[model samples]
Target: MSDRTRNTPEMSQSAASRRVAKVGLDSLDNLWFQVGGTLCNLACEHCFISCSPQNDKFKMMSLAQIQPYLDEAVVLGVKEFYFTGGEPFLNDEIFDILEATLAIGPATVLTNGTIITNRRARELARLEANSIYSLEIRVSLDGFDEPSNDRLRGKGSFKLALNGITRLVEQGMLPILTAVQTWSEAEHERMLAGFKQLLADIGYTRPRFKIIPALDLGAYQQNKIGPAVTEYVTEEMLEDFDRSQLICSNSRMVTNSGVHVCPILIDYPDSRMGESLKATTGEYRLRHPACYTCYLSGAICSNFSSGGQSER
Candidate 1:
């Protein structure tokens, strides 16, 4: 039997619950722009997309190509826009693209943080100063210190990311430092406290932080899949599951190829929605194990705003 069919009824239940948990795609008002696409500077050990400099599975979306969507999004009641990629800053036109995006609605960029140079910091400051909408940057850091961090991100990456955050603070922008949760309970608290201390020492006294669960995909496949006998989604959980909390239901990600259901399943062949955002709308099958992660986590990717639930 194939991996999908070999699972127990519990696994099928999990998958069904995921499908039911998805919000209506038509109700979606948030637009995610994949500016950097499938090209990232660093080849991290656990990147879900396996993004690297040469992985042009998806290409960059130019300012012109994305601008029309920004305008279209405003009409669709898209209150927020999200930018992500291999590394958004890798594109020379990233500032122009971000500036354009900020004009329509609040924008958030998920970045590795190692690429934020002094020039980019100045641009970020300018974007915040002139725009009526807000701009937030989420910097991904695996650990508070070098040894723990470099283990996942690579040598010298820890220091470089810290430098990027330090620059954001210096530019008068408060950035959210995101870490993946991979430590024991005691170690986890210690890690949080360490981050707090590090931020204070670095002059970002009120630094925001988000810790994420590592999804079993890409490089993580080598580590292991979900538990040996993990449960899938089922219809029963839909009784109380908040479909709006699930990103795939309402939010569609625009990639180089076209649109996809969500960011997590970009590399999945069947996850492709269509050739355009207008063509991609409706239900998505929660067939993959990763779907179960979203179902159980309840908004792991898009749940947070600066201080409140994401403006849906």
Candidate 2:
């Protein structure tokens, strides 16, 4: 769960289909790269982007393609960098890209932890050691056990992911384990306890967990993970709201196609804001269905967030 997608806003029948609100880019603090594009080793059922081995809709980004953006980001005073895709490790140039990014700012990579071999884990440690900034690895998992997790992420995925986490922990890299919120509110503590115990078993005594709000998009909604989005952020909604809480107010994602408003809406054509980061720093209409999710959950796609669903 990016702890993403659906935040069922209670609205009247007339307000059910309201006009989209406008959110401007106040600053460029964070920039994301679809570095792996849509090429992931595992096709998780709840993935908003629907990435997989066969899904090559967006190609892996090369170092040459990403350099210009990094240069522009430096000029913009961007403080952080994020990398995601079907899986960032799928790209051959991922380490190179990471090396270049860390030299400029702190970097975070979202991954499935399926392909983190001992060598790769060691490489990640080396990258962190070589940089002045920090390197964060966020590994995604569905459920705690084989049956619960494998049901959504593929067969034998639990073992593979567990091994990946273990390898990272052994290398002294405390990778954050991320999960989409699929259980009930009452089950939250129970589920977290289960995950804590699971991590402890893998020598991760100080485990960090990121509970993602499930986004009702792509394969997630297709698999009936959550209800279809039926609400939009209206101008009225922002009357007394904190505009800075929204991701579109300060973040932009870079895919091979172009710069997008946000990562959650990458599959939508209208999400593409502009060709470059500088050009894209303008007002964006919160028109996509996914915007409602972000409205309920404050900026669901940031490493600093620990599942922000309690506020506007």
Over 4 Å off, model 1 = 1-23, 225-230, 306-312
Following a full C-alpha superposition, what root-mean-square deviation does model 1 have from the true structure?
3.8
User: Cα deviation of 165 in candidate 2 (Å)?
Assistant: 0.6
Worst lDDT window (10 residues) for model 1?
1-10
lDDT of 2 by residue, 199-292 (tens): 9987899998888888888888878877787777888888888777789987899999999999888887778988999899888878666787
lDDT per model vs. reference: 0.77, 0.86
lDDT of 1 by residue, 109-165 (tens): 899999899889989989988999889899999888899888888888999999999
Model 1: how far residue 169 lies from native, Å: 0.2
Model 2 TM-score? 0.92
